[model samples]
Target: MYRKSKSNGKATYDLREVVTNIKWSTDLNFSAGELTFDLIQNAHPIIPYTGDIITFRWDHYKIFYGYVFKYEVKEDNTVSVTCYDKSRYLKNQDSIVWQSGTIADRFNNVCKRAGIKHKVVDKPTHKVSAEVCDGKTYFDMVKSAIVKTRTATKHMYYIYCNYDVVELRRAPYKKLKIIIGSKSAMTGFSYAVDINNTANVVKVIQKDTKKSQAKSATAKQDDPKRTSFKSTSAAGKSTEQWGKLQETVNKKNKANHAQMVKQAKDELRKKNRANKELTIDCIGHIDLVAGNAVTIKINDLGKTLKNCPILKAEHNFGTDYNCHLTMKVGAEWLGNS
Candidate 1:
């Protein structure tokens, strides 16, 4: 998937598919290429003019079929012609030359129409010098050269085949439309899933274990150091008895301390067990882990929502131990446009 940051700070758009039904145009003289057919015009719409023609040695090329679609007279005493597509221009099936006169003419017209600018450039001579390479025929090579040339140029959001940019013209649409000329159908488009604003359905599941609760018990019985009572200056019999009594008390205390130590160890084991986890089949999926950001197409941003980023990526392990994901709700997610 191609990734880019959002142009607008508020939201980003991820394109899901290569949408069609857009308009496009090109520059071609009547001799080499055909002009679009207009019923009112006497010339065949798809036929090129073969007679002697007038050539203007200027920055842009213009032609006058039967009528002048647009005209501009500059201070230099040079009049220009602008051709507009009176009818629809179909893809592939029709080879029609679209125009709006000169670059200035098309620009002014497009400004009036509130549209962008798109240009198709001419192919280099060396590229079309030979046939297409690697199963690509001569026509395919020509088409490729045109598309590639346009793509190489800066500010070319889209490119088409057999199109030459003599001068700037009004864009066919108000928004960006990248149409891969029919020739490059094999390499149609690069796709990415639009995960924007999908947090409601794909929640992140936290992997944190809850803390166990129990009274804090000290292992005091396990402590080797303890106070002991001793008797001195007593009657010999009394002293002996006292000594015996002290020994018995010490033994009882040691046993009790040992029992408490064992109990403490057992309680710790139970707490560890509570935190243990296991893998199992036929289990439900949980929310993905919360993350920083994700990459996606620019056109996928819908009109309703805002920023959304990808969390954790999916992975596979040796069937025994697998990492789980936990997604927590948060603020805005950032992405490339």
Candidate 2:
């Protein structure tokens, strides 16, 4: 069901009977959670205009609150509306010179500057040294802070929309809390694994080329002409299993030997893993969005994954209440097994 609100007057709309073709989807890699629905006009004498407020609910649970950014009139007197949560504003570009703050701190500052209501659920324990944004979107700023935090503290944070408020949270914010089997809602499943992106060896090199400034003691240890450092993370076992695939990253400024090593290890940790994915079909869970956790137990294989991440969730409220979820499992690539 949904309610439409405007300045001139207030009106309530029960979409249970009047609206058809209702669907909502969200992805962890995307910035927006969308709502698409077609409203039957003959059943109701109401037409939602652009910029109108849409308060959508499912079974009395507030699912989304957004503005009507688009609307189309059909020849059959039907209105199709598309709305997005507060993350829509993240698309705007801005120039910000942010420095010396934690990820939570920068998130608060960005939300405040963008007029976005936000809350920090799980604060990262690392502070950002500095970041300069020139003609970058707000989401890009958030990502910069996240990258710095992850590199320094080895923690990954997830961001999502809670109603109209942007929430900066950690992983496993919400659990699927359902079993998957023949006896449960689990209907069918398919799995695949690929090593196209696998990289057992990662190297990070730092270069300092400012000739005007004096070099530090560490820089003096290297070639006197210039300062350079290289760090590598190579999984000897994985390299033998798969071929030797290496990649290099270069930075303009300077980082200590330890920092460079940490960065290389981080890169190896991510690239070394194979991409394993599971596509599942089951009954719809209204609260199950991207970045949530779901547990799966395969009795035949005698395997159970406790913190499987939900990468994409598409909930359909059309003919039957069902959802299709794509889970990106971080389980190490098992070669061709």
Candidate 3:
């Protein structure tokens, strides 16, 4: 059953009876899910509108806590409501300065400035000497913090919203395993490899304030000078390469060149993994969500993908409480999985 309630616990509404359809989805790359649903408008006690706080619960699990951003009434007397997760509030809001603390501390500080409650499930061990959130939204600041923070093993962290709370956690390793085949719960599967978006090299430039100079570093896929090609039986190898250049102004005096190089390489790896994507569908797995580690075995491909992270997850519910899931899965090199 699905339920909507006020954030302050003042009132509650049971939407199961009137709900026609629901689409709840979340992503590791995005802070919030774009949630939408349709309801039969037959004198419902509460009218959902913009800025109203609503919590979506599927079965016993509270799936989403979001604020309604849009609503419309159809000619057929049905109401459609669109909502976004709490991170929507953080997207455009600025934060105060935070200095000399762990990534969790910085994250909590930003949440406090945004007036949102947050919880750190897995704290990142990396510590920063000084950090400032000037001229940047809370969302953008947190994303940068996640990229800077690393685990004891040097793996990057991930951020996501768990209902009303914001969670900072590490990427999934080989924790859960799922097999895809005709007899399994898997319903569909597909993959795509696009070289168009692949970047073999990344050039990161960081400006130095006091010195009035800019220090730059370049990270390449294989060899910085050599161009590598693969052989295909059908045709001779071609040398059409791709490259991405990123520049950031580092105001901090303590910024290290080695850290900047690592960051550049991490960014390149992320682009490479995103280029090779796989999507799969299955019966509703309530236990599955973004950031969960699962090993996927495909009989047709005759290969097992270990420590694959779920990039995106979509949960659909129908009139009769039927549920299904569609998820995008792939390797995220920054996670070191």
Candidate 4:
């Protein structure tokens, strides 16, 4: 009797080359009755054979990608796979191409082997009213969502949901979060929001904006120009305060630029100094200061003191002067003789 040995190498499986190149669709149907793969007349149907596996993904929309569960076929041509989901539909509904199968039967076989118990419902659960907000950059809205959700929910972690923000009337509530650059000519202030529970974040923004506007308004009453300044500032209109703010921003930018330049110069100087090949020629005269002892190279002993310019020739003349100092670097320092 000969038996086929299981091997990951190509020789063991005849159709290994065939299975590797198959095109698979990401879309899956998750209805209350049962979550099932939508089959379209073998266009993207599951190949009915051993060693063929399909992974069950739970939150395809989030960062935490789903896992894969192994499946083995029984005599009935139907197979069972284990998953973390515990739902009436999910309980026994997950199936492969049994030649023909529905969500319920698929759910049962998988659930049985996986030891997942679930209730069988006669009808599908009603769809929840949710929305998907796509592509609309919800800068402040998303940021506010993060803060509020972070404050409110403990288990819900914020992940930057990067997708074409699609706004749907019913489904998951989608807040269109976009990142507008500082140079972007957008009217509103930009913010980085947490995406833990975005709906709550939007609500918080709505709540917070009102408070901000109210506070702004109340403050404007004390300074009438403040309101006018803000309104006009959007259109590039300049008020004294606005000018001051602009000046501050400009000055900060200029200071940053200057500091960067200075740092670069210092770095270059240090690098040059470290190079053994590099030499620094001192062109300027060094003057002697009185009361400060001087060390001259023996060769420089009698060089014309005229060009060298005495910085300090005498010191400890306690009788007439504190210390006579002369230098090209500084003014002459000599008291009454």
lDDT: worst 10-residue window of model 1: 274-283
What are the clashing pairs of model 3? none
Instruction: Report lDDT (Cα) of residue 167, candidate 3.
Output: 75
Better of 2 and 3 by lDDT: 2
Question: What TM-score against the true fold does each predicted structure earn?
Answer: 0.15, 0.82, 0.71, 0.15
What stretches of model 2 exceed 4 Å from their correct place?
A: 5-14, 43-45, 204-235, 255-263, 298-303, 331-337
Clashes of each: 28, 0, 0, 33
Q: Per-residue lDDT of 231-332 in model 3, one digit per residue for the tens?
A: 111111222333343323232245466665665555555544345567777667655677775666677777576656677778776633322333345544
Q: Against the true structure, candidate 1 has what lDDT?
A: 0.23
Compose the digit string of candidate 1's lDDT tens values, residues 1-337: 0112223342322211221111112221111112221111123221112221212111132321121233344444333333232111111121213232222332223223322232423222222122214533222222333333333332111121122121221111122122112132111222233322221111111122333354357653322333333321111233232232111111223334445444333332222111111111111111111122211122322211111222222212222312222211122111110
TM-score attained by model 2: 0.82
In candidate 4, what are the lDDT values of residues 174-215, reduced to their tens digit? 211221122331122211222121111000000111222343
lDDT of each: 0.23, 0.74, 0.63, 0.23
Candidate 4: regions farther than 4 A off: 1-14, 20-151, 154-337
Residue pairs that clash (backbone atoms under 3 angstroms), model 2: none
- Model 2: worst 10 consecutive residues (lDDT sum): 328-337
